[model samples]
Target: MDYHIYLAGEIHSDWRDQLRASLKEKPGVHFHFYGPQENHDLSDAIGEHVLGEQPNAVYKDLQASKINNLRTELHLKKADLVIALFGEKFKQWNTATDAATAIALGKPTIVIRPESLHHPLKELSEKANVTVDTIEQAAQVIDYIFA
Candidate 1:
């Protein structure tokens, strides 16, 4: 079955572009990207690209409070998976909260941190199924998991 993967990442950073490109390459994969819409602008470009062509695929924009509700609804309505991009800094409440939620849900969480930065997640990184330094590495993990 096709998996619905939610991408969590820094909106303004280049990581967003990388994530979008990786998801686009994987045709059958559905993704729900949760992040700050104002800074990320994901809905305008990447989100539209993914959903525009693939009618079967789905993507949802959600606030932190809505994530669990959306996930539960989506999972019940269809099979799903969660792919989280654990970017640098736990400063943002939403990023940290989303990561925690994904982990708590027992979804297949993949944490991506830049090689330069040490893994910022104290206990949460331990829960992530895989941790990688780059988007390429994360994409490989996704390919492996979804393959």
Candidate 2:
């Protein structure tokens, strides 16, 4: 069976890339990721200009919001489990939202909090299926979930 895994985390560094590489080595698993820097084309350039011009316009327009929301919904539906990573930096709103979405959908969700433990995620972690402290621990949980 194909196992779809949704990854939620900060996008500033190469963590996603590293996780993707490691997870891809596992058999029968597919990783889905949506990041902040997805739109880098001409339209994205214009959209960035619009966002820069209007602080209230978070997504450039309604279409962007719809597209992102639809994408998130599709991924959530397809995902058998969700894994969220909280690095040394801190937790991000988007990552928390993704993890919460998985929880709301009744999917098994794992949250990784490495350094900062006393953040907003602590509240959510209480409700999550599992809260891990390292990527290795998260992987072991994933194995248990899918096994």
What is the TM-score of each predicted model, taking all chains together? 0.59, 0.71
Residue-level lDDT for 75 in candidate 1: 44
How do the residues 1-147 of candidate 1 rate in per-residue lDDT, one tens digit apiece? 445556665555667667668743456655555434534444434444444433333434323224444543454233254545655554555556666776776667777766655545646667877777788888777667656
Model 1 TM-score, 2 decimals: 0.59
Question: How far out, in Å, is residue 16 in model 1?
Answer: 3.4
Regions of candidate 2 where Cα sits further than 4 Å from its true position: 23-62
RMSD of each: 9.8, 4.2
